[model samples]
Target: MKKEEKLEIKLNVQKESWKSLWLMARRYGMSPEKMLEQFVADLTCGAGSGGSDERDLAERWYYRSFEMMGEDTFVSYLCSDEDMIEEVMELKGRITKSEQYISEVKKRIETGERIFVHYGKADKKSLIAATWEELGYESREAWDKECEEEIREEKEIVSENEERLKEIWENFQRARASQSATYEEEMKKLDEFLEEYGKSFR
Candidate 1:
């Protein structure tokens, strides 16, 4: 194997700026040279190319400090609880609404109550009594029309609920996939950081 040539470069900056960099390096629990090397490497690699695309320069450096940290630990540092909570609440809200709607539909079915149009009748009893034979409806055709209307509405609700369920499932899956991708990217960055940090220590 061929050995790569190493070059030493000296950077000129204001004392205050160097002091700030030194402070940052100390905060990162690494030496100033290692930190500067990382900065150069990061800039060379292009700043938002990795999974941490959303993060800024300072944020990336902060995360680099926890190179050996787990997702749970990284998550705490990232303060992603608000995002997680929002996702959970949205999912719960969707599920609760669906459950409540189903329960109401079941209750109406069990009670034999009118869920759709009243069809000009005061109650279910009157509606049923108003059939063709009872003359409550002008004709059998009129009664069938009302029945068809109710059936159409019931079908519509069923279709709407099916669509709603599908949407909820799709949204949940998308959110989960997004979270996984973000985590995977973060883990990749951590692995790279750990490797670099190890080299710096050696």
Candidate 2:
């Protein structure tokens, strides 16, 4: 694919199960990641309906039927008047510049380049601080404080969502089961009444 080519592509994506993505990836001689990007591009680049909420629509188009691997996100666009190549390069530069902080702060994440793993266990903050120190800046007390607060907020949101979802699902199941039980009991009573009426008629 030329970095500067502006062309429309149509891609058929197998949903979150990722079974079809893997197959397409192999067929295209590219990684599953590359296949997924092509799939998202074709979907969100206005090749088709493009749907509402492009990002969510892309996720659905790619994996609604499949199990979620994780909640990764993507952003795509259609070039209106600007040069697409320049836009792509500028976007890439923006991302790379942000990521440069990773090497300065931490390295080799998951065997490639280390990542700052702040799962927010008690030593996580210290490790992040050390990464900043390596980058020739003492980890700022203010920033560290902000990070801790942010981490706490994240934990609260996750915990709240989990509880809310669980409560709603449990209530749904109970309602279903209760209705089933009531229906069965009613059927049993109807059958008994019919048996008595038949005996009287005889």
Candidate 3:
């Protein structure tokens, strides 16, 4: 085997591209050189090829990060699965309805509209109502009590969604950790291969 020589290449990149690369390198806790080298190695060996499962996982992680960063204007990668897409659409519809309901309630409160509630035991029910009358009416308290259960349920729904988001974030973190571990193992293998190859020329 002939000895292989290492060559240094100087490449020009846009400032924004450089910044993005730097940020990604920092995100992975890697030096820019190692980060770029690994990316090239992965690309060359088709480890990050678009059709590969690993690439699909990486793409999902990419979109998930964007979603976490509030750039979720587009459909999520998870939505590619028919079942997941249906579930997400349902949740989104429910969330939209909840928001509209809350907004209407707030508008009604602001406009001093009357809110009515059924009070007393089931056998002795009476209709009670209240509004924000100018003479220091106690309608606000009544209104709050009237909607207390509903408000609590809404809060619980919001909390559940938040917990789900947190779970997704944790899953992404685990996936990222696994990818990093695999990358390190691949780098080690490449180093070993290069070392053996170098010795073959001696």
Candidate 4:
């Protein structure tokens, strides 16, 4: 796969859970930081039983670094919970394989070029996100502070949470209008979840 620009997301290492991740890290005979890096690489490479679509997997995560969007990106809050790290670890193990990935890989062997498993991703699920953003991002870089500021100003910063919430709500709303996942059965299930869970939130 050719190198394509991606949205970057910076995440802080959870200090409290560092010990636990470190425990796993030490078993590999590496420092906490180094082992964590390797762990991240393996996790993305579909280490566990769950196979992953390599093409879309690249879209979902970066190597140790957060994902990159266009230029006007903004972080609205921090996740203070220690459990978030555990959640991330668990989630990383469940990634699926893709077929839209690049199939050619080049490696040097002593005798000749050996054909090994091409690390190219097998799927292009990332297009979904890129497409959705392209639909609404008008001349705005996905990671630009200026554009994010403008969006904040337009909403007057009543709360960053409001914007984050809407970011998801808007996508689902768009998906619904576009008939992405608005099949009657799914919608009915959603309605059921809403009716059951929504009524309890208050």
Best by TM-score: 3
In the range 39-122, model 4's lDDT, one tens digit per residue, is 454555533322456434654655235533322111111122324323322222221111111111111122212111221342
TM-score of candidate 3 on Cα atoms, chains taken together: 0.35
CA-lDDT, candidates in order? 0.54, 0.46, 0.52, 0.39
Tens-place lDDT digits, model 2, residues 1-202: 6565454556565576577667778996888876556555656664343346765666665556644542211111111223532433344344445445443333332232222343334464555556555534365554455544554555555555545534543453454443333434533453454355346433
Could you give candidate 3's per-residue lDDT for residues 34-75 as a string of tens digits?
Answer: 776655544444433434654556566665776566422112
What's the C-alpha lDDT at position 136 in model 4?
Answer: 42
- Return the TM-score for candidate 1, rounded to 2 decimals: 0.27
Q: Check candidate 2 and list the clashing pairs.
A: 16-63, 16-66, 17-66, 107-114, 108-113, 108-114, 109-113, 109-114, 109-115
Model 4, residue 82: C-alpha shift (Å): 31
lDDT of 4: 0.39
Position 105, candidate 1: lDDT: 53
Top lDDT hit = 1
When sorted by lDDT, best at the front, the candidate numbers are 1, 3, 2, 4
Model 3 pairs whose backbones collide: none
Which structure is stronger by lDDT: 3 or 4? 3
